[model samples]
Each structure stands twice: as C-alpha cells, then as structure tokens.
Target: MKYKNPVISGFHPDPSICKVGENFFLVTSSFEYFPGIPIFQSKNLVNWEQIGHVLTREAQLPLKREHSFIPSQGIFAPTIRYHKGRFYVITTNITIRKTFYVWAEHPEGPWSDPIFIDGFRGYDPSLFFDDNDKVYITGASFPGAGPEGIFQAELDIDSGKMISESQFVWEGTGGSSPEGPHLYKINDWYYLLVAEGGTEYGHMVTIARSRKPYGPFESNPHNPILSNRSTKLPIQATGHADLIQASDGTWWAVFLGFRPVKSTKVHHLGRETNLAAVEWSEEGWPVIGENGRAKVEHDAKLLLVNEPTPWLERDDFNCESLATVWNFYRNPLESSWSLTEQQGFLTLYGQSCTLNDLESPTFVGRRQQHFNCEVSTLMEFSPTEEGEEAGLTVFMNENYHYDIAKMIQKGQTIILFRCRVGSLWKVVKEILYDEPSVVLKIKATDTSFTFSYATPTGEEKVIGSGETSLLSTQIAGGFTGLYFGLYATGNGKCSTAPAHFDYFQYVPGQE
Candidate 1:
C-alpha cells in the first residue's frame, strides 16, 4: 500500500481507464514504441501490472513498410471499454489517420484484427456505451481549419462504423486546448472530460455535461474537475485522464502527471501516473483530491499489484521474447529480432544507413525510467570494412546520442566512444579492440554518464566519461523517455553484421 503520486511511472502518457467488475484495466498512448498500447490491470486503481500489449501483432496495424521508424507518428491515445460480453478498444495511429477498433471476449485478448473507423482526425479516441446498448465514439482533432475541440459521433459497435455525424460539443475554456476525451454517464447527465492547455505547464482537466449523449452539453459550473493546480499543487502536466469507480463506490481518476526536478527541465522518466479521489458535490459536480486544494493523506489500500517486478537491467538474456523492459523505437520487422534461436544471446540484425533511415529499422531499447542507473551490454560485430559500426548507446531522439562502438577502420579493429551532442559527432576517446567481440557498459548518475569497454576476455577500461545534462526534456524536448539500446549503421553494403547481446541490464547504486 502507501501509494503516492505516479502509481505508474515512465512514459505512460495519455491514460485511458475502464472498470470491469472489481478489476480496473488501463491503457496509454505508446507512440512509436513497438508492441504498442500496453494494457495494464489493476484492482484498487493504484498499483498496476502490465498484462500485455494490444498491438503485439504487426498485422494489427498498417505500417508504411515492414521495418520503419514512425518518428512521432505511431499509436496515439486509446480508449478501452467493456460492452455486453466483449471488450473493445478504439484508437488512432496518427500516421494512419483512420480510427480503428479491436475486440476480444476477454481483456487478456486474442483481439480481433483492427477494423478501421473510416474517417477521423486527431489522436485520442474514446468509446462510450449507453444503458440502451447504443454506442458512441469521441476523439480530439489534429489542427485544421475546422473547430479544434473534442468531437463525438454515434457508432455501430458490430461493424465499427460511425452512424451519426460527428460534432464538437464544447469550444473549451479560454487558453485551454481541448483533447484526450473520456465519456461517462453519472446520475442523469452525460459527462465529457478532456485534457486541455497542451500537455505541459498549462495542462488541465475540463468537464461538460448534457442530458443526451450528443448535445449542446453545458460546461461544468466548476470546470477542470481535477488538476494539480486546481489544488495549487506541485505536480505538473496534470492532464489526459481516465476515470473509474472503486469497489467502495468512490470515484477515482488516474491521469498522467510529472514532477520535474526543476521548472525548466524534465528527467528522462517522461510522465508519471498520478491518482486522485473525486467526489460529486450536492449540486452534482466532481470535486478532486481533498477540500478542493487541501493535501490528502497517502492511501495504502489502493495498491493494485502486490508483487514487484524485477528491474529490467537485471534481466539475463535467456528468454524467448524481448523482456517487458525492451521496446522498439518504432514498428519492427518480425524477421530481424530473435531470442530463442540465439540460445542465451539476443541477436539484432544490422539494418539502415543511419538510425533515421526507415529500411533497416530494428533497434531494441529500454526506457530510462531512473535518472541514475547503470546499463551495460555484451555483444560482437563484424565490420566488412571502414564505415561499418555496431555498439550500445544512450539514444535521445535523432539529434542526440552517445555510444561505445566497435568497428573495423582500414582493417584495424578499434573501439571508440563517440557522441552526437547537439550537432556534430565527436570521437571522445578510442582504444584498440584486438577482437571483434566486446562488452560495453554505461553508468548514468545524476545526469552525467560514463562509458567503458572490454574485450571478450580482457579487463574492462573506462573509455570515455562526460556530462549528459543535456539529455533532458528542456534540452531535447519531446514527450518521450530517454532510451539505451544496441545500434548498427553503415553504407548498407555488408551482408549481415549482427550484434549478439548476452543481455542488457539496469542496476541502481552501481559505479
């Protein structure tokens, strides 16, 4: 028990929650991460456990190619719901534009392939079912000439088609940008809650209500039913919420929020999930936290998963599939990655001219959830000639990265730790690699990182160490977490130079 802010941590943005009996299921926008849209199961709305991912099969989504980096254009906000005996999820992949639907008899799904919702724009999509068995789907629109707010439309659940014309319900309060819509029926009114004011400093939650599913819904007299600032609190980015009811009949909201170490920067942890208690006033508007802005005591009874998950960095690469810790930067080709065939090693097939090039798209990485942790990998690479390189790196977007790599330059085997900080790639240090196989380790502590390397049978040596303070959100602005992964880039002339990773692990309190 003893739950505080962020029951779920690290890049878990735009949360959508649904209640099935006494259990609660939550999902979030996965962006370019592979096995998109992680589905989590919780009981008390606090501690959560990752049950599985909805977009596990590549055929579930239509990608531009077999292997590609979507670059901020993958799965966006997703809404999950249960109707009759089937569970349905409606969502959008910004790259795909069309809204899509998938369902299963059980939440842990053998989910049917996606059924595209013909026409829609903007990312966040929510599904609502009325007591009469009628269905409605709502979503936010990407910028265009039309009204920029949340839109709702009736849907035929069996066919995943919008029946009625979709329309905006509210223009949103001044200074707030409406997005991330969640619908619910409370008492005699239909409540529509959305995240507005962007996803940063001004982020907030707003609500509107109407007697019918689609209508001239009136704004809540006290809009922004729940937000960190409504309580004048310190947590930032208090938007993108999903609401559910507790077994005790108490209403609760689980939304994404972050507490930055400083106002100007964000640690690579991305957004952390926060919890709040909601209550309907006598007049019937929801009140958040304690008395409006009062600080509430930590509730221990809300813990969802009792067992703890072993940290990702500690995993021994001895599994058939990538660990829950690993996520591809974008959609991956199933043919390139393997764990079981390699026996004790995780093999990554080399692809692409550069990391951004779409063809050879295969990078297996893990989110940098902790600011200070150690990540290391053991691997080997065969460089056909100069310009071929494979190694382990701390990657932050396309513009920033640092790596400890092994390459054959002019037929001489060498190990180099280099960085592409800001604009240029600088070779910070270099050492002779007598063998093609080597081990690379990175220690990140308080924003500074150090790189070390070792021959397959030689002693380890510190190759390079530098300040990684710029690897923060303020410097490398994005709505994502820092990642560490195995990488290979060349002129695309080599047959195959695979990196065999004994394992990739993260350990805290290590030098």
Candidate 2:
C-alpha cells in the first residue's frame, strides 16, 4: 500500500502512539487550544479518525487564568498508554508547570480528572508498564532543574505518587532540549527514545538502552534513529516519535514534522503527524524510516485498505453543537457564542476582547490543513459601534495575524483589512460598504493569502493580501499554526450587536 506523509495533518504535533489488540490509538499536543490533546484511532497506521480529546472540560484543562496566558503555553506533549483495560494520557501543562495524567475506560472518554504528579518536573511524560507489573514514568528534565537529561521514576498509577526518587538517565546524543522521551521494554533491554534539537529544523530522535528501567544507558551507535535535519525533504523538523508494534509483529513510528512553504522554512500549518516504518537491526537496535529520514510517501504492508477519512468542509451551523473540528482560543464564555440564537446559523456575540488580547475572544476556527486552500463564510453583522467588527482572520497568534472584517468607521459602514506582525500593525485596505450581510473569502497559497468580499448580489472584490511568511512559525516564534477563524470583537467595549454566520466552506486545492 502506498500512503502519503502526515497521516494526521495540521497543528497536530508531538505524536504519541499505543496499540491495544489490533486498534492503534494516537494523540498529539494541542497547546493553548481548548479541549486539549486530540486523540485518534486507526485500524491501520495510515487511516485515522478523531475519537475525541483527552481534555474536554475546563476542569481537566484550565487554559485561561487570572493573569494573561501566553500563546502556545498550555498542554505541551501527551503520551497515551493502555494498561489493564484502561487508557491513560500523561502530559504537562506548562502554564502552571504541572505534570498530570488522566485515565479513561475507553479512548472516547469520560476521562478522570487530572492526577497531578507532585515532585515531578519537566514535560513530555510517558508511562512504561513492565512485565513485572511495575510502572515507570520517563520525561525530559526541565532546564536548570539539576542534571539536564532524561529522568525516570517509579510511579503509583492510582494516586499519581512517585514511588522512587527521580533518577537521571541517559542524555541524548548531544542535542539541545532532549525531550519527548518514551521508554519501551523490548526483549531484555529497556529502550529509551527521545527527541532532540529543540523541535525545529535541527530536530531529531535518538535512542539509548539499558538492562534496567533506570539507566546508566548506552547511546545507540546510530544515535539519531530518525531525523530530517539537514535534508531538503518537504517534511522537515522530524522528531518527537513514539514507536508501536502491530499485530503482524511489524514495528512503526509516529512522529511530528512540518512542511515548509515551497523553498522557505516557514510553515504556517504547524507540525503534523507522520508515520514511518521501523525495523530492528542485526545488532538488536531499532531503525526508522529510510536511513533515518521520513519520506513524503511510503510503501508498506497494511492490514487494511481503508480510504482516508474525509473532512467535513462545509458547516451549515444547523447542528445542536459545534463540530469537533472547531476550537476556541482558550476557555470560552458560553454566552459569547450560540447556535440557537438564529436557527441554522452560528451566532457570535461581540465581546470586549479582541484578537490581539491574550484573553479568549469570541472566536471559533478550524486548522488550515492544506497550503493551497479556499475558505469562505457568509456573515450577517451590523456593527453599530466603531470598534465592533466581525469577519474572518488568518490567525497565527496574538502577535501575528491578518484580518478582514466589517465595521462602522466614523458612522460609515466599511470593510477593513488589517495586518499585525509583532509590534507593527497596519491597515492594509478599507472600503466603504453599507450592507447588512456579506460573503468573506480567503484564498491561501504556499506564499500568500488573498482576501476578498462579496455583496448580496454575488459580486466579489479582492480587498488585500498578506504574505504567508508573516504568519509562519519562523517569523511568529510560536509552537502553533495558523487557524482560519471566524471572529467577532468589540475592541475594548462589549457590543450588543451579534454576528451570525450562515455557513462556512473550506475547500482544499490540489497539491
């Protein structure tokens, strides 16, 4: 079977995988987005469906705080494991510097509240269940918190207590930020796999092994088992991998990597989940991908020939609840958005919060899965106040974003196109338009994003365009990717006006 890379695409990063019987469950970091740690299930390695999120409630993930929450500072990396008929997801909340694990009977949960692992520091925590029924937690040690390396400790799964003292294990093959550690008890050795080089262009996966769980381990002769560091491959930043063995006794690795736009090292869609074949060497060490590089496509013996699950592109907002694809910035106010306010339309009440605010604004969006895509929405908004605006935004973070909105400027209804890059903010275009409703569209290519608006009579006019590099991780300096968001904001004061979106259509262009 031939399959493409990024089995799971867009904003989904730091992939961790576990197998139960013939079903494979995987999870990825959701950083700052609500309902964190998206979980997916796959019968075969390539075809995956999102079962649900691990943190669906505010109690499990309190991303919003009294102090301003920085973007890309919430859930770091999550490792999902199945033990004794129960599923566990262990991860870190960097905002509060807490490492916790939640358990559920099924992948689609009713997950338990977080059981905080006190005295455990750092992130990317993974659980290893030994043949003797002992459980171990391995994670990357936080910088400046003693010896910098991978650490291990015996953990009581019931109470989330550390049964043994934290032991400094193997430091990776001399790479910066040796994180995303996963331990596997294979044959007679405890294999430790960790990602290094700081999750960027230099990112890599390295391995070490020891006879015992707590190591004094030896590094692999072929240290970086998987990486694309210096390569010209479309999929860059390859690392943060988790290995899983199939029912047919074949091994596979699920990792996080990003596709830069054309020749530039700017990826606006974020680090995506990719899969590669794994094989054991004659020396009993594991090898990944092709010569330590993940390719754009793979030919593997898959157990099932399932077609890739199609994404729901057009949302009419007639459902009782929002689709799982939609996400909020953080903990959203329930009253700020509604589906029943206007039947068959998604209505967003204008809040005092704006896109630039660290707080959660009246925003809902889906990930930009493809580089070449078209997103269009029909919105009915009458902004009486000067600051009240409602429209579409290609949002990367609070610091970097491009917006095209309808608002009232000096008592005249106008369409505004604005761009914000760091401290520099500019109004790219503004046009006077006295209309009750309008169609907003954004066409994205590898290099640029074009914005346009259409009147009720169906005449569309291009407003402005912004370079895709402006909202890229390299320029924005965030762990997140761009989101095609539908938003309503009142700048500083709450507005009584509401913005109702009749429908949202997202169509991906041919590669």
Which prediction has the highest lDDT against the true structure?
2
Q: 67-124, model 2: which lDDT tens digit per residue? A: 5444578899999999999999999998778999999999999999999999998788
Across 90-169, the per-residue lDDT of candidate 1 in tens digits comes to: 88876666679899888778889998887665568889999998888888876882688888888898888778888877
Q: After superposition, how far is residue 380 of candidate 2 from its true place, in Å?
A: 0.8
Q: Which lDDT values do the candidates have, in the order given?
A: 0.74, 0.91
By TM-score, how accurate is candidate 2?
A: 0.98
| Candidate 2 worst ten-residue window by lDDT | 63-72
**TM-score for each candidate, following the candidate numbering:** 0.91, 0.98
Error of 1 at 430 (Å): 2.2
Clashes of each: 5, 0
Candidate 2 global lDDT: 0.91
